[model samples]
Target: MRVTTTHQLYTARLPNGGAAVMDVRSGRGQWQHLNSTAALLWNQVIEGADLSKAANRLTATLAAQGAEEAVVRADLAALVSHLRALGLLAASPAPAPDPAPMHVREVLPAHTRLSLPDRAAGLLALATALFLLRCTPIRAAIAAARLVARLPLRPAAPERADQLFAAVRRVRSAWPGRAACLEESLACSFAAALRGRAVTWVIGARTAPAGAHAWNETHGNQVIGQDPEDRIWPYAPALRVRHGRNK
Candidate 1:
């Protein structure tokens, strides 16, 4: 008799307190909301309990609430379908064998180098801009300036035009070199600053007349540069609005 082994599955926790399980090989996915009933079923399944026994227990508990036997059976069938689709359960030609343990590894190499100073300064500037942009009653631009002043290290003083140009240039240079990670890090920094503020943060990209570019806008509807409309989303829209100007 030929024997087949059921492949192990993986699970990920979602931001909304839900859980998703998937088969690495089959690419099937299933999601379960962490409600009281789901929590009870999950505990039973995880404790090496038999599937039919678990279903019976679930049916008995819900039956007390006037749930019909057919409804309980349907729920159990649906749960089984979800688990099978996610590769959590499988019927081998023979009886099922114990699943192997799993392990996870880091995506990026430990040796990857990052410029902490540049990244930190960029984050600080992003935070200051978001705070000023989102606050009610619209505090003076000095509030923004003061926030920037509190950063550990400051970019060199420059003319207003120069400062804007530098920020644009830095982002442009970083994009090609670090790819998605760099973009994601910058977006995260920008998002962190905007948290709890009324402003919205959108990260978008578009092909510009010059090249593909990304930029932000604020509530004032001001485009920050000559190419502000280059089809990109900025870190903070409110801050972008205040700073953006049409060429």
Candidate 2:
């Protein structure tokens, strides 16, 4: 079976140009480090290179770069064994069922409904916020707000979180300006904060097309605002905003 990444973990590039794997599902925040060579192998596997292909590519890349071939082979083997042991790389992928249509309210909790206020006033407010964020230096705009968000703020209930996110998305759809992924994520998180909820904001990038995307997640590590996973699932976490701090 070919090794592949599991969706249960988050992958990020460390400052030293290696990969850091964190299993947020455990809620413990433990991290495993991978050196540059291993990180490249991680990326290759995520790109669907099987065991042999990944190894050959790793060897070839190192040899071309004038690294010792024997050392490269040993390191590659060790990295593979370590990844398998950690369960980050799997032998086979689990079948992913098709996602439901986006606008189907049934997919969300049945109890939560968008109220008249949410559909109108809340929507307007969200649109305005998105517009302002788009026009301003968003990071600077978020500076003051993030201070309050980091103070162990209370979380919005699931129903409310869903409603706020829906409002942001609804407004974004009608926006005449360019509301990119970062803009949308910022607007959603800001709107949620105004309603007294603090969510984790994430910005990530993938190398294939070499682009970035943004989204939000709850403090409990549940994804909030939607992201197009197909384009982003292989992305390494780049910047993260949480508890009023950007990391």
Candidate 3:
């Protein structure tokens, strides 16, 4: 089997010299923590190394610490099996796309509201996002939103984008379950897309705290739903789903 990763995976280097991997294929988002040994193997796989190549590199590294080549190879093979079973390792050499580069500016002002129709659309979008997140993977959910947004509608104005963001927040306020940044950001972006507004949904990771977050931003480079007191600025985006000109 090839040591390829799926597009649904998000990885980050920890501040304390470890690695974090998240599988968002399921909407719930499963996590797998990697130790130093596992991280070495993961790095090799991510860099497009074949099984034998990864084994050679791992054996050499382990040898420096006086480990036997046979033992190291066995351990590597076992670890690869575990990872493959977890759906982290693709069976073929299909390369996944790189993470979107991070480029963000000041936060958008929170002073906007939607009209009656827009409010209805926004509410429906939030409801759809909530329901889909419970059943489908994040990738499918985002794709659904993109499909809906493909209608020949005009691009949303800056104020409209702000209004949709607020609308999503308002709708989420009434939800019984506590919605984190991931759900909130995805819902907001979906709502904007429903109105033919193309925004970017960003997944960012913070090194110091060793955590991840999600948020939305407009094409003008203004971050949506960002607050001065929140931890938004501390997290660097690890992945982004771009719709328009947002860089």
Cα-based lDDT at residue 119, candidate 3 = 70
lDDT, residue 78, candidate 3: 90
Inter-residue clash pairs, candidate 3: none
lDDT of each: 0.35, 0.58, 0.65
How high a TM-score does candidate 1 get? Answer: 0.32
Error in Å for residue 151 of model 3? 5.0
Candidate No. with top TM-score: 3
- Per-residue C-alpha lDDT of model 1 across residues 160-210, encoded as one tens digit per residue: 222332342344445443323213323322432332111112222211111
Candidate 3 runs further than 4 Å off = 1-8, 12-19, 25-27, 35-37, 58-87, 90-114, 137-139, 146-160, 220-222, 236-239, 244-247
Q: Between the candidate structures 1 and 3, which one is better when assessed by TM-score? A: 3
Every model: Cα RMSD to truth = 19.9, 13.5, 5.7
Clashes of 2: 1
The runs of at least 3 residues in candidate 2 whose Cα sits more than 4 Å from the true structure, single-residue gaps closed, are 1-112, 117-132, 142-145, 227-231, 244-247
Better of 2 and 3 by TM-score: 3
lDDT score of residue 89 within candidate 1: 58
Error of 2 at 20 (Å): 12
